[model samples]
Target: MRQKTQRRWRILRRIDAESRALAETLGIHPVSACVLLNRNLTEPAALQHFLNPSLESLHDPYLMKDMDKAVARLRQAIDGQERVMIHGDYDVDGVAATAMMVRMLSALGVDVTHHIPHRVDEGYGVSAEGIRQAAANGVKLVVTVDCGISAYEEALLARELGLDLIITDHHQPPPAFESQIAYFGAAVAVLNPNRPDCGYPFKGLCGCGVAYKLATALVENLGHPGNALQRAYLDLTALATIADIVPLRDENRAIAQFGLERLSDTKKPGLKALMGVCGIAGKRLSSYHVGFVLGPRLNAAGRLDTAETALNLLLTRDDSEAGRLADALNQLNRERQEEESSTLQDAELMIESGADALGGDILLDSDKALVLASEDWHMGVVGIVASRLAERYVRPTILITMGEDEGKGSGRSIRAFDLKKGLDGCADYLVGYGGHAQAAGLTVTRGQLSQFRARFLQVADEQLGADDLIPVVDIDCELGPRDLTFELVNELRRFEPYGHENPGPVFAIRGAKLLDQCTVGANGKHLKLRVGFWEASYDALWWRKGDNFGRFSRHQLLDLCFSLDINEYQGIPSMQFVVKDVQPS
Candidate 1:
């Protein structure tokens, strides 16, 4: 189902002579310059870098707080021929990070094994049981990827078990201590850019990026000094970076651009097999391919079961094993989709059904944030459902699967609200919680469900105002029939592989007369309309908006916000407006 929430259009462009001057100086379209200015890239050098972020310009790995310590510890482990375990979470980011570490460490002659904690049994982060088991297995060094920032107790457990730990994580660290030490000084080193004391210039790195940084530093510390080795793993870094939904700014842009290039011709059988299964085998990859097409499949293993399948797909050299793992991940993703759809339906019914499903006589609209739960809901699918509800309702939403004594839930919040901070405010009611500002996972005892709900709503109320609850569709600029051209669309295409922090440009046009309209696609699931401003009539495709066919009529003046695209048919290419939002003018 699609979200029904109407969005407020926020036009970001204004008359700016600087953008015009920049366009003239840079020999590019003024619209592109305006978009770059919107991202605060004014200087020519900065604009150039933004347009083409290169791997050669990556920040020094040693700039991170404990990169040296982490590298030195890993070097010691290698010298001693000690067994090292790469601890990872079950998600794509963690699995990618783990895969990179295993490859890098194995190449350096280290006896490397990896552990991906079971979602149900071990939950998340550096597991205490995992640490003890690693010790029992004669693993002398434990290195965590994509997790362990919040593993204070687990860090202590590793220390008690006489194991040296090097933590590489990207999650927001807890409130600072006096020393600014990483992970409560339980391990040898923690390499996280988010550590308050870490002076790493780019803090937008996802967990896999951090792991790549550590790998770079470690390899540079040893005989290999250049980035040839680092470039080899860009495929994994890019995959995890896009999958993790981190900002695509600074080095991340370079990592993604270069990594996507490498992924197109990846040497790894596992990635190739995964891509083949995703039906993107020979295509030049982009963030969309990774984020939407491949990411969910890789994430499915972690969500439905363990991340072993996904991790194996990244690590396996055998084409047969890679194909098997890819197929397994694809099957798991289908199951995950079914679970997510069912849970979303259940939650939507609960929201619309009113007082009986939701709490009290108050309707859902009365609360600033939703906290919906069901015993029948699968824990793995709640996060996906929460994201859907948050998008649909235009507010923060938490979906919990009730257990006998406790409930495990996930919360996805609007950009205006910080979910992690809100969970911090309700820490007293939660057993544990950790994640970024927009998404978080939590465990709450069954007894405190109502209290937690009330507290979370209070937090949302305190942070979000009436305006914040309404979603905003940012319009890069306005365009008329004359302004929409093949040239403009071609220039906008420069910002390919757009994602977080760097979204594709959305343009709006006002008072376009709807000449004709019809439904398209299976079950009439899409809208195909012809709208004109003056002498120019353009076709518009509103994906999944066929249900809105009744909203407007022929000859009606309508306002449309859309992104430009060139639709190619056979041997010819024609301009197509991919509509995002539409309303009667």
Candidate 2:
């Protein structure tokens, strides 16, 4: 069966005068300038910076709130030769962040160790048991990377155990009380951009980005070559930044831009081995490689096994050990994929069943939200399943793994809905919850699952409008077939390292005729087409869209939304179009 397209297409409107002015001043095509303008790069300096992000454009690390304090404490620990513990989360961001901090400290001649919480056992953040263990191990200082922003109780516990705590995280802090002066109660320093009081210019850094800032400041304060050390750790920072799905703008853009360059020739044996195993070594890397290939491999260790496996891979200097760990992680990733596919299938089957089977939950009635639960679902893969479900259904989706008494839930939301806020509205049913606007995690008691599901659905229904349900195809600008030149495509390369806020441009072509088309790929799941207007024609690849092959005939007029790409075959690079959506004219 063919799936129908349910997206609303809107071409971005641009002021002709502004486009003309920008094009003339920047000495570029009007369409390119219009795309920049659409991204809010209007000011001359801003446009220049956006096009050519420089390493110097990165803000000073000291500007972050508590930077000086965190640095001073860390320097003292280093000077005193005290034992320090790096506490990190279990995901890719946390693993990279932990590795970055550990390496920086080790280079500074400090006695440092690291701890990554077990995904199913310890849960997220700095756990009380972990801090107690650190204290038992004679650790005088504990710096948490990628987590601990919401560890109010754990912070207090650290204080009680006489362990100094420094929290470096990017996740939203727990709500502060009106009378409370700071969010992380007993921690010596908390470095997070999301804190309301912090005045750091850019607030979009991921957890690893925050950890990198701390590392940068610590390296510089100790009279070391800060930039040199920063360069060494850029691969790790970039890996986490991309994997964590942070916005690639401002300092982040510079970090990813330079990091990708550095990652191409990474000297770290673990990363080199990982790249080799993933079959991306020696290739020019991009956010795509980090986000898809390497990130998942690193994350798989934490998901199915211990995060320490990934951390050890990052810290190991032995080539043989690195290869073994890389092989193990690759195996774990394969296992993770299998679990994800099985869980996704089970979730879809549950959805296909009727509401009566789900105890008449409101989620079944409104279809505005989905709250799927199963005792058999693996917790690590539920988030991926939730993301897929949200994208497919065009609504917020929560997948929960039911335990004996409580259930752990992960949620993904459509653009119009704020998942964190939705969870907040249903807080009465949740034991605890946290996350950002688009994604979140929660814990709900098995007894209250029905109530939470109904309440979450109500929140989605009340908040989401009918228009918000339809997916949107936001065209950057309209381009004629004549504009599909190699020069213009090369100029577009200036907008590199696209992610989150800074997206690759999408252009629409009107009244194009399909010259030839065919179903391709395994299972004929891709549509390969030659489309053109007048005398100009280009090859187009529509992925997973072969079901629509029957809708088109040769010489049929169609409107196309697509992104320009460069496809290389036998060392010859040629222009190709990635078809996003096609409709009859």
Model 2 C-alpha lDDT versus the unseen true structure: 0.87
For each candidate in the order shown, give its overall lDDT on alpha carbons: 0.87, 0.87
Misplaced by over 4 Å in model 2 are: 1-5, 177-185, 355-365
The residue-by-residue lDDT of candidate 2 on 1-585, one tens digit each, is: 124347789889553888888889889988898889888988778877888899888999988999999999998897899999999999999999999999988887899998999988888778878999999999999999999887878888888889899999998876652234443457889899888889999999999999999988887887788679767999899888889999998999999989889888888999999999999999988788988899999998887889998999999999999999999999999999999999988887777674422354434445688888888888998899999988877889899888899988899999999999888899999999999999999999989999898888889889998778778989988987778888888888888887888888899888988899999997898999998777777899999889878789899998889999898899998888899999888
Q: Which stretches of candidate 1 lie over 4 Å from their true place?
A: 1-5, 176-183, 355-362, 533-536
Q: Distance from true position, residue 2, model 1, in Å? A: 13
Among all windows of 10 consecutive residues in model 2, the one with the lowest summed lDDT is: 356-365
RMSD of 2: 2.0
Task: State TM-scores per candidate.
Answer: 0.95, 0.96
TM-score of 2: 0.96
